[model samples]
Target: MDLLTPDLGLFIWNLLAFLILFFILKKTAWKPILKSLNEREKGISDSLATAEKVKAEMAQLKSENEALLAKAREERAALLKEARDTKDKIINEAKDQAKLEAGKIITDARAAIEQQKMAAITEVKNQVGNLVIEVSEKILRRELSNKSEQEKYIKDLANEVKLN
Candidate 1:
């Protein structure tokens, strides 16, 4: 109970000292503390704003990258398709040329075979005609040895011709 109640004179002295200290701190420390706090708050806010801006730019760049990738894929697909078409066209042309060459070869072979057959037939006929002429000449030489036999054979041939 005694410690809880202070003397009036002591209370007055303590109040006076507190007022002096308060005024001194207000003039010297308050402004600097408040200014430092405000500067820290401003710096924090600026950092947050910069982070948000960077995040937005990153999102935009990501979208741009996706668009470029899609375009590249489309171009690659088109190029592959064109290459396939070109390959097919070249293969078809080669096949068609091969067929033409085969047909031409067959036609030439047939024409050559026909020409060889005709040449064989003409040679056989010429050989037969020459043999017949030689046999007839030999028979005539043997039968018509003198003029009397030739005249007798001519009379017999003329008489046989009249009867037929």
Candidate 2:
């Protein structure tokens, strides 16, 4: 049992050695080690703060981008609507022009038909007049071939003229 326990002399020697070592380490290494640990902790804190700031900026940028995208969509929709309206207006204008053209064509056709009808009637009247003149000339020539018939025809013309 005595061999298993520590001796007083040995304990005193160990205590002195421990105190000397503690003083030496405190003077040489403790300050620098503590300062380095503190600096490391400060760096970590600053990095975390920077990360938080960056996250906030990213969120703000994302929101702004979304707003711009929405604006773009609205503008695109407006442009499309304007294009459709313009197309409709152009189509309606073309329809109106076509209708006008059709009306003019119909009017022209009617005028041509009227002129053709007048021309046909004039041609028929001229033919009838010519036929009447030819028949009168033939009858006159046949009657004037004899002197007695000519004398009789002249006396008949004189009496008819005096009566009129």
Candidate 3:
């Protein structure tokens, strides 16, 4: 029972001592502690804001880079298409040139063959005519060995001509 109950005088003394100590601490430590807490909070808020800004800038840079990459791809595709077109044009031109050259070669070969054929035909005809003349001369020399015989054959040829 005595431990559970406090004396009036002791309660008054304890209250007085607590109030004095509270006032002393308030005057010495409260303002500095509050100011430090406030500064720390402000610094944290500023850092968070800066981080958010940097994140936004990174996102912007990423979008810009994507756009640039897309543009470069388009340019590359266009260049490839142009190169293909040029290559096709070159190939077609080469084919056309080759065709023309082949045609010209064929024409030249045909002309040369025709000229050779004509020359061979003329040479064969000349050779055949010369052979015929030589045969006729040998036959005439054998048959008309005597002048009297030749004169007799001439008279008979003239008589046949007169009958025709």
Candidate 4:
């Protein structure tokens, strides 16, 4: 029974010690502990707020990047269309130039053929005139071959004149 029971003097001494320790701890440690707890709470709240702000910024950046990608795609399509149009125009122009060159070549060939035909016609006419002159000279040379034949012909012409 005595072991389980506190003595009166011991109780009074314990009460005094408890009162002193409470006062010392209240004076020295309470404010620092409460301030540290508040600072820790504030730090946690700031970190959470910063995280949320970063998440929002990241979302905005993602949206902006998607928009930029879309714009780049549109620009690329327009550039491709323009390049195709330019290529078609160049091809058409080249075809037109080729056609013009072919026409010029054909016209030049026709003119050259006409000039050759005219030259051949002139050569044939000159040859025919020479041949006619040669035939006439041969006939005239046969007719005037002998002086005795010319005298006999003159005597026959005189006899016919006297009979008439």
Candidate 5:
């Protein structure tokens, strides 16, 4: 029973001591504690704001990177297409040049063949002319050896000419 109920004077003294301690703490430490807490809250809010700004900038940079990548891809495709077109044009030109060269070669070969044929014909004509002269000399020498044979040959040649 005694432990449960305190003396009135002791209770009053304890109350007075608690009030004095509270006022002393309030006067000496309360303002600085509150100021420190406010400063910590402001620092946390500033850090959060800075983080949000960085995140936004990162998102913007990511979008810009994607745009640059797309542009690079387009440029690469264009370069490849141009290269393919240039390659095709070069191949076509080479084929055309080859065809022209072949045509020229064929023309040259035909000209050479024609020149050879003409030379062969002229040589054959010259050989025939020489053989005819030789044959005529032999025939005239044999026929003209006798006056009677020569007269007969001349009369025969005149008759052949009149028939023709």
Candidate 6:
């Protein structure tokens, strides 16, 4: 019973000390603690907003990269097509040039062959004329060995010419 019951003067003094301590803490520490908590909240919100902005920029950059890649692919295809066309054109031109060159060579060869044939014919005719002259000279020398034989051969040639 004595422990449970407090003296009035002690109770009044304890209450006064607690009230003074509470007021002192409120006046000295409350405003700074509240200001620190508000600053921390604002920093967190700013960080989150910055992160969202960065994420949006990354998405836009990814789309731009994809567009650039598509354009590069199209350019590559066009360049390859142009290269193939150029190659075909060059090959066709070379083939046409080869055909013309071959035709010119054939024409030149034919002309050369025809010229050689005419030359051979002329040579054969000249050789035949020379052989005929040599044979007639020998025959006349043998037949005209005596004057009487020469006269008889001349009379025979005249008679043959008259019959023809």
Q: What is the TM-score of each candidate against the true structure?
A: 0.68, 0.74, 0.74, 0.73, 0.77, 0.69
The sequence of per-residue lDDT tens digits that candidate 5 reaches over residues 67-161 is 99999999999999999999999999999999999999999999999999999999988876776676576566674677888778766654544
Write down the lDDT that model 3 would get.
0.87
Over the stretch 1-164, how does candidate 1's per-residue lDDT look in tens digits?
A: 87999999999999999999999999999999999999999999999999999999999999999999999999999999999999999999999999999999999999999999999888878776776575556547776678998777666654544211
lDDT of 2 by residue, 51-100 (tens): 99999999999999999999999999999999999999999999999999
lDDT of 4: 0.86
lDDT digits (tens) for residues 46-156 of candidate 6 = 999999999999999999999999999999999999999999999999999999999999999999999999998888887767665655565576756788887777666
Model 3, residue 54: distance off in Å is 1.3
State the displacement of the C-alpha of residue 162, model 3, in Å, after optimal TM-score superposition: 38
Model 5, position 6: C-alpha lDDT score: 100
Worst 10 residues of 6 by lDDT: 155-164
Give me candidate 1's TM-score against the actual structure: 0.68
1-164: candidate 4 lDDT, tens digit per residue: 99899999999999999999999999999899999999999999999999999999999999999999999999999999999999999999999999999999999999999999999888888776776576555545667568898667555544544311
After TM-score superposition, the amount by which residue 82's alpha carbon in candidate 3 deviates from its true location, in angstroms, is 0.8
How close to the true structure is residue 45 of candidate 4, measured as C-alpha lDDT? 100
lDDT of each: 0.87, 0.88, 0.87, 0.86, 0.88, 0.85
Residue 22 in model 6: lDDT: 82
What ranges in model 6 sit over 4 Å off?
1-22, 144-164
User: Model 1: which residue pairs collide?
Assistant: none
The 10-residue segment with the lowest total lDDT in model 2: 155-164
Q: Judging by lDDT, tell me the better candidate of 1 and 2.
A: 2
